[model samples]
Target: MARLEVRQSWLGDVLGLSQSVVSKRLRGLLPFTGPELLLIASAMNISLGELLGGIVNEKNPHPVDGGSSGVAGGRLDLPTSRL
Candidate 1:
């Protein structure tokens, strides 16, 4: 959030959570839910893919492993289900 000058307390307010909860999530003590991620992305004015570091432009389709999975490590890859 340093890049955008977003503070934890402000993010907590945006997500309707406490600063401690946001801190825990930021420190990896707790995981961020899908809805929470969406809210964070919306607040940051970025797409969910970009927030998750999973955006893959067509020009550089094969970045991490010579595939276009979008997700670099293939760890947070979501299933192709329509919303």
Candidate 2:
């Protein structure tokens, strides 16, 4: 979220998420769909490759459609590709 703030000039509220929520998501404990990755990347004004922390081998591992999986606070809807 700091990156988003510094690099993209976006506040947490602008992304419709709290700072803690965004921070939790960045822990990478759960899998993120293409669109979710895209949203985060766009919000941070960075590339997906950078978002994945240079994990090129694991890029595009899953097809993003629609689904909800249990997360910390609640189920998060998997995002589809917006590209």
Candidate 3:
């Protein structure tokens, strides 16, 4: 948010949530729902992967690339098209 100069109140307004709720999620006191994450990512003009960058496995940064219809680590083999 600092990078974007987006205040908590503004983000809360955009997400249709209260500032406290947004704060809790930002502080890790509450988890951001998938929809909320998608909203934030869209608002920020970024991809969902970039929004969830912290969830990546540092040891194996690239995706495992499991066979088609198989799971790669915990992520599915999905396309990178922008939402």
- The TM-scores, one per candidate, come to 0.63, 0.43, 0.63
Q: Write the per-residue lDDT of candidate 1 for residues 3-82, one digit (tens) a residue.
A: 67778888899989999977777655566666676787899998876766644556544334443332344333322222
Greater TM-score among 1 and 2 belongs to 1
Candidate 2 Cα RMSD (Å) = 8.8
Please, what are the lDDT tens digits per residue for candidate 2 over residues 46-77? 77656555343454332333213322222233
After superposition, candidate 3 runs with Cα above 4 Å error: 58-83
Q: Per-residue lDDT of 29-67 in model 3, one digit per residue for the tens?
A: 555555666787799898867766755457655433422
Q: Clash totals for all models, in order?
A: 0, 0, 0
Model 1 residue 57 distance off true place after TM-score fit, in angstroms? 13
Q: Using lDDT as the measure, which candidate wins?
A: 1
Ordered list by TM-score, greatest first: 3, 1, 2
lDDT, candidates in the order shown: 0.62, 0.44, 0.59
Q: What's the lDDT for residue 25 in model 1?
A: 70
What is the overall TM-score of model 2 with all chains considered together? 0.43
Candidate 3 displacement at residue 26 in angstroms: 0.7
- Tell me the lDDT of model 1 at 71: 32
